[model samples]
Target: MSKYKLFLLRHGEGAWNKENRFCSWVDQKLSEDGVKEAQDCGRLLKEQGYKFDLVFTSILSRSIQTAWLVLEAMGQEWVPVVKSWRLNERHYGSLIGLNRAEMAQQHGEEKVKLWRRSYDITPPLIDESHPYFLEIYNDRRYTTCDVPIKDLPRAESLKEVLDRLLPYWNSTVVPEIRNGRTVLISAHGNSCRALLKYLEGISDEDIASVTLPTGIPVLLELDENLKPVKPRQLLGDQAKIQAAIKKVEDQGKAKPST
Candidate 1:
C-alpha cells in the first residue's frame, strides 16, 4: 500500500497580523517578515526533498502570496493551484480591522478570549457601516463563489468555518489525495485549525487551544485508508515554532500599561 503526503500551512504574518489586528477577509498582503518567512519555509521543504503535486489556497492575498513564495522557492511554480473562499480565515465580522489587544482591553480578556478561541462563540456580525464591509462583500474574488453575495457569512464560529471548509475538502481535496498526489494547502490560522480538528478528531474544547504558527509546514503521511500513519509532523525549527505559537496566543491579551 502507498502512503500519501499532505502539508498544511498557515500563511505568513500579514500586515494586519503584525499590528495584532483581526484580518479575516480584508485581503491584507503579507508583511516584510511574512515574505521572508514564506521563503524560508520553501527552503526548508526543498532541503527535505519535498515536491508538491498540487496546491490549494484561500482567495485572501496573504494566503495566495504565501503559496506563490513557497512554490517559487521549491522551483515548482508550474504546479496547478486551486483557490477557494471556503478556506478563508474565520470571518472576524465587526472586528475585521480592529486591534486585538485593544479589543481585549475594552471587552475584558476573558470575553475577547471567548470570541477568539471558543469553538461555538461567534463575534458580532459585520454591519454595512463597518469600514471594510462594502470592499469585502463587493470584491471580485467573491463574485465567483458558489453562494450568493448575501449568503456569505458576516461572522462565523470555528464550527461554521469547518462546516464551510468540509465541502471543499471532501469534494475536491480528498479526490486528489486518493489519486496519489502530494498536496499543499496554504490557508489561515482558523481555517487550518478547522481542518486539523476534522483530520485529527480533536475535541472542540481541546481544539481551542491549538495555535498554528505561520509559514511552517505541517506534514502528515496518510495511509491508503486516508488515516494518518502516525502523528503529524511540523517541519522547521521546533523552538522557533513554539515561540511563534506563543506570539499567536498572546495576540488577544491586553498590552500592559506603560
Candidate 2:
C-alpha cells in the first residue's frame, strides 16, 4: 500500500499573462511577480518538508526559470532536471501574439472560450506567413526536438496537447514515479491541464472547467496503480489561489471599454 507523491505546477505569471495575451509557445519570460511567486512556491514547499528527487520542465525559458527558482528556494538546486519540448505550452498558432481580451471582443466571448478552453477545437493555424513563424521555426531549441521542425504543431487543441504529452508521461514520468521518487513537473497552464485530464480521467466537457492557478503546487498521493488516493491538494493561501484561478478564468472574457 505504498503512496507515491507527485507535484504539478504551472509556471508563474509571464509577461504575456500579465497583458492577457495568448503566450502559446512564443517563449516569454516570467514577470516580476512571477519571479516572486516561483520563489514563494519553493519556500512554501520547503516549509511543508517536500523535497523532489526529479524535476521536469518544458524547454521554454519561463518554465525552466520557475523550476530553477523553486528548487533554489528549497535548497534542492542539485535535483536532477529534464527538459522536453513535449511539455511546452499548447501551440497558439496564428493567435500567438494577439491579446486575449481583444480576441474575445472581436470574435465574441463564446468563440474565444471555445478556442482557448475546448478539448478539440483548435485555434487558427500558424503558417509561414504568420509574423512569428520564422522566429519560432528557426529557434535553436526546436532544432533539437524529437521530431523535425516541420512536423511540430502549428495549432493544437487541449486534446492535441494531451496527445503529444502522453508519450512523454508514459515513457519518462511514470517509470520514475513507480520507482518511488517524489516528482515535480513545471509546465504551462494548458499543458498542466492536459496532463490532469489524463491523470484524473476527466471527460472532455468536465476538463474545460478545470483552471489551474499559476505558481501553486498541486500535490497528489497516488496508489500503486497510479490512481490518486483522494482529491489532489493545492498548496498555498486559499484566497490568493482563488484569485489566481479567477484571473485565468477571466482571460478569455471581453474587457469592458472605458
Candidate 3:
C-alpha cells in the first residue's frame, strides 16, 4: 500500500453561507443543496473506488455532516471520526453575524474587500461579552487549548489558522499517515488552505491566494515518507467548483442592503 491518501474537503454550503455572512467558527448547518452536494461528492468518490481508513472533521455541524455524507457514499459509514476545534473554521471575529451587503454599504466595498480577501489581515474581533461568544465558550463539546473567548474573541488571519491547526496535523494527522492509513478531512476553506500550505510547502504570500471550493474533495497521495506522491486531484464539476470559490473570494464585493 502507499504511504496513505489524504482526501480533503471544504464543507458544503450553509444557510448563512447563502446570505453572504461570515461563518468563521460559527455553528451553521448545511443547507438543502449542501446535503445533496455532499451526497454527490460521496457518489463521485465511490465511482472512483476510493476508500478511507480514518475520518476527521471540525466541531461545526456543517463539517460534521459533510464528513458523514462522504463516508456514507464511500460505504464506510462505520469508520471512526475525530472531531476537534483545531479543525474549526477560521474565526471571523466581528464579521460573524453581520450581513455582507449591509457591511459593504456601511464600510464601503473597497474596505470590505480588504477585510474579506487580505490573507494576513484580520477583521475586528468579537466582544467576549457577546451572546455568541458566551454560548460557544460554554459549550462542552467544543475544545480548545484554552478559553478562546478569553484569548481570541475576534477574527483571525489565514496565518493564524495555520499556526493553530498545523500542530494538530503534525502530531495527530502525520502519525496516522505514517501508519499507512488513508485519512479524510472534512473542514473549512481556510483550514484546508492551512493544511495545503504545509503539505505543498507554499509560501505565506502564495497561500493567501489559494482557494478551495465547497464540497469538492481534493485527493493528495503521499509517498512512504509522507511526502506528496502526486499533484492534488480535485473531484466534482470544475465549473461549479470555480464558481463557489469565486463567491468566497468575493465575499464583501456585493452591494450592501439599502
Candidate 4:
C-alpha cells in the first residue's frame, strides 16, 4: 500500500440522481442501486487492503451515507469523520429539481451543457423565493458555519466551487496528507472535480470535459507535494469502471426518456 494516499468517492445514485435531476445540495437519500454501489465500494476497499486514517464528507445525506457504508465495509466504522459545508456539492441554484433532459429541452442543449460544465459560467442563482433557499436557511447544519446565513451561496460555478474548496484542502486536507494519513473523501461530483482540478493541475477550459462517476473510489498515490505519481486507479473490475464512467459522461447528454 502507498504511504501517502487519498480516496475520492462520489456518493452513490441519490433519489434525484436516479431521476437524472440536478440534485445539488437538495439532501436526497441514496437509491437502492446507490446503497449496493456504496457497499461494493467498501468491499473493494477491504479486499484491496486499504485503510483510511480519517474521512471527510459533505453534510448532505447521500455523501454522508456513502462514507458510512464504506467504513462499515472496511470494519473501520469507528474512524473519525468531518462533515463540512465546504465539501457540499456545487449548488445548481434554480435548476435543483429539474431533470437534465428536460432542462436541455427547455433551454438549448448547448446552454445547459455550459451551465453544467463551464468553469466560470454559472446557472442562474436561486432567489429567496426558491424552496431551496428556505430549506437551507432553516436547516441547522448551516448554523455551524461561521458566516451569516444570507452570505451562503445559492449557486456556484466550478471556479467558485474550487475557490471554496481549496481553502479546506489547504487548511485541513493538505496538512493531514502531509502528516501521512490515508484520507477518504465522500463528496459530490462537482466538489470532487474541483479537488481533481487542483491536484491534477487541469486548466479552466479542460475541466469541463472531466467527469467523476458516483460510487467509484479513485485512488491517488501522491508524492510529497501531492502530484499523482501514477495514473489514477479505480478500485474495481475494469469493465465496471468503464461502465460507470459512461454513465457519468451521459449525465450531460440529451436523453429521449425524459
**lDDT of each residue in 90-151, candidate 4, tens digit only:** 98989888888877777778988899889998888988788677786789888888577788
CA lDDT of each prediction against the hidden true structure: 0.93, 0.92, 0.81, 0.88
| Candidate 3 per-residue C-alpha lDDT over 82-131 given as tens digits, one digit per residue, 9 for 90 to 100 | 98888889887877878887888888887876666567787787777655
Which 10 consecutive residues of model 4 have the lowest summed lDDT? Answer: 249-258
Candidate achieving higher lDDT, 1 or 4: 1
**Over 4 Å off in model 1, which ranges?**
256-258
Q: How would you encode candidate 2's per-residue C-alpha lDDT over 48-96 as one tens digit per residue?
A: 9999999999999999999999999999999999999999999988999
* lDDT per residue (tens digit) for residues 1-258 in model 1: 338899999998898889888999999999999999999999999999999999999999999999999999999999998999999999988999988889889989998889999999989999999999999998998999999999999999999999999999999999999988899999999999999988888898999898998898999888887787788898998999999999899988899522
TM-score of 1: 0.97
RMSD in Å for candidate 1, one decimal?
1.4
lDDT of 1: 0.93
Clash count list over all predictions: 0, 0, 4, 0
Question: Which ranges of candidate 4 are over 4 A from the true structure?
Answer: 1-3
Q: How many backbone clashes does candidate 4 have?
A: 0
TM-score of each: 0.97, 0.98, 0.90, 0.96
